[model samples]
Target: MANNNSTDKQGGIKNNNLNKTEEEDEKKKNKKIFIVIGVAVGVVIIIIILILLLFTFCRRGSAGETEATGVEMTEVMEGSEETETLEDTSGASGETSSETEESTEETTAEETTGEEETTETEETTADEEAIAPTITLATYMGPVYSSADGVCYYRVQANVTGTPAPTIVWSRNDGSGLGPNRAQVNLHSPSETYTLTATATNSAGSDTESITLSWGCNRPPTVHEITLMGDHIAGVDYTVSAYATDPDGDTLTYQWSASGGSIANPNINPK
Candidate 1:
């Protein structure tokens, strides 16, 4: 009976030691989990702070650009105001000079005697018999080929008549007057057309006539091939080459365009 009691006591002590070890292991596992959770939370907080800082920096940059643009606009507005003020002052001065000239003319007319007025009336009545001006544009004989200094042009002429020999003026394509009765039009393409105008003015009246001229005398340029060199990447420049020939040996002008992005020089070849 005594031996049995001693064995039972030894077994009880072993069970207590096992239970203490299990509790210690559980505590260590819980501590490890807490450490992992804390690290994850700290990382998340740092990421949020970095994002906020980046956003703030971007906003500041945009605001700075806006301020700079506003400053430029203000400067332009001030310059325009100054220009307007100067123009107003100049216009006022011109009006004053014109008024003074008119006053002087009125005084001179008032000083004229009754006999001079009667003589002026007689001269005006004599001039009233003059006929009105007339303009006649010659039939377009197509574009006349003319080359001077390696430049091609189309020459045109017209006729005018008046009682007192009216002044004649010629204009082409709605541009400024070229001269008396002749005008020149620049040759743009084989299928292009030009409008030539003639105006005659006299004391009696004024007359105008217009004629259309189709240019098909010269051959147009032909484009053979267009090639691109280098990689097409954003923010990087690439070279574009075009092979073209003009049959008439005329000077060729190259114009380039793109659907997107920007070109350094659109008019230059190999852009």
Candidate 2:
């Protein structure tokens, strides 16, 4: 019995030692769980601080860029307004200069027109200052008679008068005249009449007068003699001679007949 009580006390002591070891293991596990929780909390706090700093920096940079852009826009708008004002001033000055030039040209045109009208009036007045004359008679100077040989001699004259003392021109069908005054003529056949015309003229007009003169004759021309140039050779060369006359200075003709050797240039003066 005493040996059994001693074994029971020894078992009681082993149970107390196992109970102490279990209590120590439970305490160590609780401490490890607390350390893990603490480490997780510290890492979360550091990540929150870095995110807040990044957000603040980005907001400040955006604000600075917005201010610089607004200043550039204001400068560009001011330059544009100044350029528009200069252009408006130049346009107004150019219009004023153009209007002045047009007014000067119009005055010059009016002066030129007045001068041309005055010149036309002067020319019309000058045209009214000239005049002409009239011719009254164109006749012979005297009452003429033919001589015994059927010839007559006379002088022709014209009478013309006007304002400005116009000049006279005389023309005859039978003879030539000198100047515009008179003509002297010797009539070969008194039966042949003459027509005399006189004209008077000046700057404004002209006039003409005419007359006819006639006579009677009863004689003809006669052939008298014709003289040759030199002597005659048989078959080489030769000349002839004769004499002819007319009382009224009329023309005459001569005819010849040949019955012997050949005559060269028979119709000529020397044959």
RMSD vs true structure, all candidates: 34.1, 35.2
Candidate 2 residues 223-251, lDDT tens each? 56665566566666556666767665666
Off by over 4 Å in 2: 1-108, 145-154, 162-165, 173-179, 184-186, 216-271
lDDT of 1: 0.78
Best by TM-score: 2
State model 2's lDDT. 0.70
Evaluate candidate 2 by giving its C-alpha RMSD to the native, one decimal.
Answer: 35.2
Clashing pairs in 2: 224-243, 224-244, 225-242, 225-243, 225-244, 226-241, 226-242, 226-243
Regions of candidate 1 where Cα sits further than 4 Å from its true position: 1-124, 139-142, 145-152, 173-179, 220-271
Return the lDDT, model 2, position 255. Answer: 59
Where is the poorest 10-residue window by lDDT in model 1?
Answer: 143-152
